[model samples]
Target: MQKSKSFAKYADAEAFRAAMEDDVRRGRYHDPHQESRLFADVAVEWLHGKLDLKASTRSRYERELRVYVNPKWGAVPLRAITRNGIQQWVEGLTTGDYPAELPDGRSPRPLRPRSIRNIVKVVMGGVLEYAHDQRWIVENPIEKVTTPRSWIRTTTRCI
Candidate 1:
């Protein structure tokens, strides 16, 4: 058996080791250095690999990745994506100081909670779906990360 690697300034070594053991024993943890890929990478891979989404979906993910996920928590590995990060990312997108610049040279409007929630939905959905396919995770992380569902419905204005 190969030895498990450790990170400096990284907490929860034992827990990670345990999860790794589960991965290995369960036949899920391939690629010895899975630790190198961050949630951002996983998100991109998930978006492309797992989703049969449209261009709009891809664009939205690109925007969110560039604006929010990449800047804030891109360096953090997938194993380290806790509910706290998800919560903070959602808050940052909606109520917090998190907006990316637009082509018009202005910061895009901040995402509403619902919109952010949907993004979270897509992201987590993709993550867990992939996890399921890989047999690494049996449950979605949504239960762990509490998110507010957007109650906004349709609105139309036409001349």
Candidate 2:
């Protein structure tokens, strides 16, 4: 496929071309077209590819995607997802600070740390990892996201 970009200066254009060539040579080049695909589209594609998952596991993943991950990221392009954005989303999930209206028309309640972590891991992480594997992104941004820690307190027994 033919791709072209116009730079303000000849030197800038040459530098970009050289970098593209170097990336190609190193087998690190990603197709720009794939980067523009919406997260929802990619997530569906990823989910459909999980033929080995049990029925219950697939159902859970679908519910998580529909309820948690998609509301925040569905329309976003693959190239637009960032580590910082994912971190903020995690914080919101823990703090009950997400949008008041979900696609299902219910208010979102704050989730427990473990639930939040599961959503991040099994939903966002899974889809983004698939995107990375498909060369839609240079790297998986979810790798750097930090989930809220679940603090457990133990009471001491006095004899």
**lDDT of all the models against the reference?**
0.64, 0.88
Best model number under TM-score: 2
Pairs that collide, model 2 = none
Q: Residues 87-130, candidate 1, lDDT per residue (tens digit)?
A: 77666676656645456676646677666666676655566457
How many clashes does each candidate structure show, in the order listed? 0, 0
lDDT of 2 by residue, 1-61 (tens): 3567778999999999999999989978889889999999999999999999999989988
Task: Give the poorly placed runs of model 1, Cα more than 4 Å off.
Answer: 1-32, 99-110, 128-142, 152-159
